[model samples]
Target chain A: MAKVYNFSSGPAVLPHSVLAEAQSELLDWHGSGMSVMEMSHRGKEFMEIIHDAEHDLRRLMAIPENYRVLFLQGGASQQFSMVPLNLLGEKKSVDVVNTGHWSKLAIKEAKHYAKVNVVASSEDRNFSYVPAEDTWQCDPNAAYLHYTSNETIGGLQFPFVPTPPEGVPLVCDMSSEFLSHEIDVNRFGLIYAGAQKNIGPSGLTVVIVREDLLDRALRITPTMLNYRVHADADSMYNTPATFPIYIAGLVLKWIEEQGGIKGIAARNEEKAGLLYHTIDSSGGFYSSHIETPFRSKMNVTFRLRDESLNDSFVSEAKKNGLVQLKGHRVVGGMRASIYNAMPIEGVKSLVHFMQDFARQHG
Target chain B: MAKVYNFSSGPAVLPHSVLAEAQSELLDWHGSGMSVMEMSHRGKEFMEIIHDAEHDLRRLMAIPENYRVLFLQGGASQQFSMVPLNLLGEKKSVDVVNTGHWSKLAIKEAKHYAKVNVVASSEDRNFSYVPAEDTWQCDPNAAYLHYTSNETIGGLQFPFVPTPPEGVPLVCDMSSEFLSHEIDVNRFGLIYAGAQKNIGPSGLTVVIVREDLLDRALRITPTMLNYRVHADADSMYNTPATFPIYIAGLVLKWIEEQGGIKGIAARNEEKAGLLYHTIDSSGGFYSSHIETPFRSKMNVTFRLRDESLNDSFVSEAKKNGLVQLKGHRVVGGMRASIYNAMPIEGVKSLVHFMQDFARQHG
Candidate 1:
C-alpha cells in the first residue's frame, strides 16, 4: 500500500501506532476473548477501560477538582444545544462572541433556547480576525458568554480567553485548538471539543464543565443531554462510545509519552510557522484570509492569487500522496489541518508541496 | 489465555471472524493508510465505509423504501426520551405496554415529555409473562402505542404484535430481540435497538423510522435528538461513530455470509432449544421465572431450586470457560444470552457445564 497523509480537518489523522494496537486487540481485548466492541458496557472490562480513559483525560488536562470531564456522544453540534439547555436556567439572555463559522452556528442554536446577545463579532472582516474584547457589548446578568476559541474553516483563533462579566461564566468551543495550546482550567466555566480534531475519533465529545454548573438544566432537556445525569454517572449512565474512548485514551497516553501538552504546542507552533512563512514568502501568489495575529496554528487556510489554478493544484498534490487539502465548501480554497498526531515530517512535506505548487502557479 | 465464552447480555459475544478481520485492519483500513477511526467523517474513505454499512443493513433487514435507517449515538437510554420528543408532537398522551425493565424505563422517560397510558401491563405477574394482546386497553387517540418486544432482564418476550387502536402507530423496542427473529417491517412504525447485542457495538443505535413520522418533533427537541434531522441527512449531519459503524457493517457481512437473518434465526432457535431443554430435563431442580410460552429465545433466565447452589454453579461454570452468566442486577440468578453471534458449540459447552453442575447440586 502506498503511504499517504490525511489532512482533513476533523476525524482527521491519528498515529499509526494507536491503530496498530487497536487491531491487535480487536478479537481479544486484554485476553477477554471478545473485542472491546463486543464486550458489554456493564461488564467489568469495559467499565475499567472507560474509567481509565476519563481519568487519563482529566489528568492530561489537569482539570480542577471542581470540574467534571464528560465523555459524551453527539459531536460539538450537540453541545451547542446542550450548553444553553444546561446553563440557561433563569437567565433570559446569553452573551456570545461570534468569531467565525462554528461560533456563529453555536449562537444560532442558542437562539432557539435563549435570547442571544452578540457581544462582539469579527464578521465585518469576513471572519478573518477575532474581535477585540474591549470593543464589545455584553450583558452583565446574562447566563453565560460563549465563544469559539478556534474556527476551523476561517483559520482564526482567540489569542486569549475573554473574561466573563462579573459573576458570569465564560464558555468556549475549542474544537480545533483545544489540546494544541495551554489553557487555564479555572478561567472558563465550560470547554468542549469534538474528538475529530485534536482528540481521537469523530463520535466522542470532551466536555469540561464546572461542578457548580451541573444542576441548572432546563426542564425540557433530554435526560441523556443533561450534564448532571452524565456527571453523576461519570459519563457511563448510558453505553458510551467504547471503541472511540479507548482510541482517545491511547492518544492521551501518546501525548503523555511525548511530554504532554507543552511538547505538542511547541511542535504545533513550529509546524504552523513553517507553513505560514512559506505562504507569506510566495508574495501575491498565495494568500491566507485570517490575519496574522489571529491565525490558527492547527488548520492553515490559504489560496492561490490565481484562483483558476486551484483545481490543478489539488489534483497535482493528490498525485504526491497529500490528500484532503481542499478547503471547506463555505470557503473555497485549500486548508492544511496539522493536528496533534500530524508529525513534523508531514508538515515539512506539506510546506514542500505548497512551495512546489506556488512555484508552478507563482 | 484461556478461551472463555462470554454470555453477558449485550456488549455480549460477536462473531470471532469479525474481530479477527477488524484486528487485521486496525492500523490501515483497506490500504487507505489511516484507521477508520482516523478518517474524517466527510472524507470519501470513511463515507464509503458508512455508506456500505447502511446499505448492508438495509439489505439485511429488507428495509422498506418508505422507512429510513438511521445510525445514531447515545444508546437506548437516549432513545427513551427521544421517541416521545419526536413522535408525540403536541399530543398529551401516549400508550405503553409494561412487560419488564426496559419498557418500564421507557415509560418513565416518556412521562417526562408526555402523558403516558398503561395500555397493557404484565407487572401484576412480576413481569414473568406477556399479557395477551386481546386484553390490552390501548387508547385509540394516543399518538403511538409503544411496547418492548423483548425484555433482556426478565427473559420475557411478547408472543405477538398487538394491534394498535386507530390513529395510533405501533412502536417496538426490539433492543433485546432484534435480528434474533425476523418480523414484517411493515408492521412497525418505528423499531430501535442498541447494537451491543445482536448487531455491532453499544455506541450505535439503529432506528428504522417511517417516513411519515419524521416531521412532527416538538420545538423543544434538541437537533441531535430530532429524527427529522437524522432522516434528512441520512444520519450524517454531524460526525458519526465511525468505528462502530465499520464493526457493525462487518457483522452484517458476517450475517450475509451465514445466509442472512433467516439462516441465523434458525441457528439461534436450535441453540436456545438445547439450553431450554437442559433446564427442563432437570425437572424441579431448575426452573425459569418467565413462563414457557413467553420465555425469550435470545436471553434464557433460570434459577436453581436451591439458591445456595447459584454461586457454585456460576463459579464452576467460569472454571470451565463459561463467563458472564450472572443475571442482571435487577433480576438475579443466571442468564444465557444467545445472540446471533453465539455458536452452537458454545451452547453445547454451556449445556455440558450445566449438567455437570446439576449432577452435584440436584
Candidate 2:
C-alpha cells in the first residue's frame, strides 16, 4: 500500500523486521505445527519465548540481579493505581512530582489509597518545563517518591531523577522514554513503562521492580495486582499476554540485531536532533512548546505561528505520506513521536515536510 | 522441518488457515502500513479490529442483545478475584461447586473477597465425576452461584449448569471448553473463558456478562478490574491485547467459514466420540478417570490399566508425531486435549496410534 510514516504517539511504530519475522512464523512456529498464539504458555516452546524475552530485556536495560522484570497487563494506567497499592501500604503519605497530565492523573489515582504530597509541580508554568529536582520536598517517612519521567501528553521530561530523603524509595513512570536510552536500573525501587510507546505493543506493560519492594502490599491488594505473586511466578501467575510477549520478544531480538539499547538510543537521539534543529532554525515560523532543557527526545512538540495553517499542514502532510502529525487534544499543536522504530529517514522526511509546510504558510 | 502435533491444553491448536492469514498480514495489516500491534487503540484501524471481533464473537456464540462481550487481560485466574470483587459487593455470600483443581482455586481466591459457600463438591469422589446440580444448596439471597463447567486438570465437566435460586445469578467458568459447542447464553448471568484453550491465545479472556451485572463492584476495586469500564469502552478502556484480538477475530472468521459454531460443534462431537470409543472399546486395557457423563469433549483423559505403559505411551506417541500427551502433574494419566482446532484426521491418526500401542503393550 501506502508508503507512510506513523506518528500516533503510542501503539506507535515497531521495527519492520520484527513484524516480518513474526508474520513468517505465525502459522507453524519453528515447525511446531502451531502459531505462537496457539502454543501453551506452560509448554516448552512458550517457556523459551518468555525466558529469552525476559533475559534480553534485562541485559538491554542493565537491570540488577535483585530486580524482578514483570510482563503485566492493564498498561501504565493500571500501574498508576497498582504502584501506590503495592508501595504505600506502610506509609500513609506519598511524595509526588507533578510534571504534566499523566503525573497529575497518577497522583489522582493514588489519592484513593494514600495521602498524596505534591512536592513540586510545573503546572503553574503550564507544564512547559520540568521542575528542577533540587526543588522537590520529599517525605522522609514516605513509602516512596513517585514521578513521571516523560509525560506523553505534554511532551515534557525530567532530565534527571529526583532524590528522595532517607528510607524513601524513588519510583518513575518511564512509559514514553524507556529503551530510548540507557537507564541506571539500581537508581529506582520501581520503574514501569507501557509498551505501546517505546517498547513492543499496548497490551503489555513492562515493570522493573526491586525485590525489596515486592512484599508489603496492602491486604486490599487483589491477588492479581500483587507484585510478589507475579515476580515469584515469573509473570506467569496467570497466562500472560503471549502474542504481545512473542512480538515483544521479536522486537527485543531486533534491538539486539541493532546492537542493543545503546545503538538504538544513539539513533533515536540523532533522529530527534534533526527534527528539533529544523524547528529551531525555523526562525519564529515554528515554535516548540517545552523549554530546551526539558524537551523529549521521543516526542517533539511544536506549533505553527499561523493558527489556521495547522489544518492544511496536517492534511498536506498526510497526502505526502506522513500520518498522525496532529497534536494531542490536550496540547493543540503538532507532535512527531520519533519512537524506537522511527528511522532517521522517517524523521528527515518529517523535517522536510515541516519545512515545506512552513514555507507555504510563511 | 519436523512435523508434530501439539496437544498442550489452552493455547492449544489454531486452524492453519487462520495462521496463514495472520502471517500474511503481520507487518502491514490490510495495507494500513502498520502491524495491528503498532496501531493506536483509539485509532480507527484498531477500533475496527475490536468492533469486528466483538461482532463476530457475538454472532458465533449467539450472545443475546443484553449481554456485553468483554476482551480482558490477566486470564481467567484474574476473573476468579474480579468476579467476587464486582459481583459480591451487595451480598453476604456466594455459592460454589467444586469439581477439580481449577474450581478449588477459584473458590480459594473468591473466599478472600466473599464468604464463599461450597454448594456441592465432587472432591469427595476424587474429582472423577461432576457433582449433580440438583444436590446443590445455593442460598437464595447469595450474590451468585459459580461453577467450573470443565475442569482442566481432573478432566471432569458438569453435565449442565445448576439452576440458581431466582435472585441468585448463575456464573460458569467455561475457561477450558468455550466455543466447543452451542449454549443458551440467556441461561447464565456471566460466562468467561480464557482464550488459550479454544479461542485464540492467553492474555485475552472473553467475558460475556449480562449488562445488569456491570455495577456493584467493591469500592476498592481497581478501575481496570471493573467490568463497567471495559463494557463502556467496548473493551478498549486501556490499550487492548490487539494482536491476540486480531487472532481471535480471525479464528471467529474461520469458525464461520467452517459453517459457524453449530457445524464446528458437530465436528467436535464426532472427534470426541471417536477418541472416547477407542478408550471404551479397549476392553479394560485402558481406563478413564471420569464417569461417562462428565467426560470432556475437548480433553480426553485416560490411562492404561498397567500404568507402567504411561511413559512408553507418551514416548512412542511422540515418535509418531504426537506430543504433549502427558497429563497434569496433579493428575497422573495421559490427556489428549483436542480443542476446536484439532482436525478429525489428527484424532483418527491418534486413535490408530493408540490401537497399535495397545496391541503391543496389552
TM-score of each: 0.98, 0.98
**Which residue window of length 10 is worst by lDDT in model 2 chain A?**
A130-139
* DockQ of every predicted complex: 0.75, 0.69
| lDDT of every model, 2 decimals | 0.87, 0.87
Candidate 2: which docking quality band?
A: medium
**Clashes in candidate 2: how many?**
2
Residue runs of model 1 more than 4 Å from their true location after superposition: none
Off by over 4 Å in 2: none
Question: What's the C-alpha lDDT at position B240 in model 2?
Answer: 82
Report the C-alpha lDDT of model 2 over A1-362, residue by residue, as the tens digit.
78789998998998888877877777778887667877778888899999999999988888989999999988888898799899986689998988888898899889989999999998899899887767778779888999999888788977877778976889999999988888788889999998888778778999999999988799888888889999999998888888888888888888888888889989987998898899999998999879999999888888999878889998899898898888889988898888999988989999898888778778
**In candidate 2 chain B, what residue range of length 10 has the lowest lDDT sum?**
B1-10
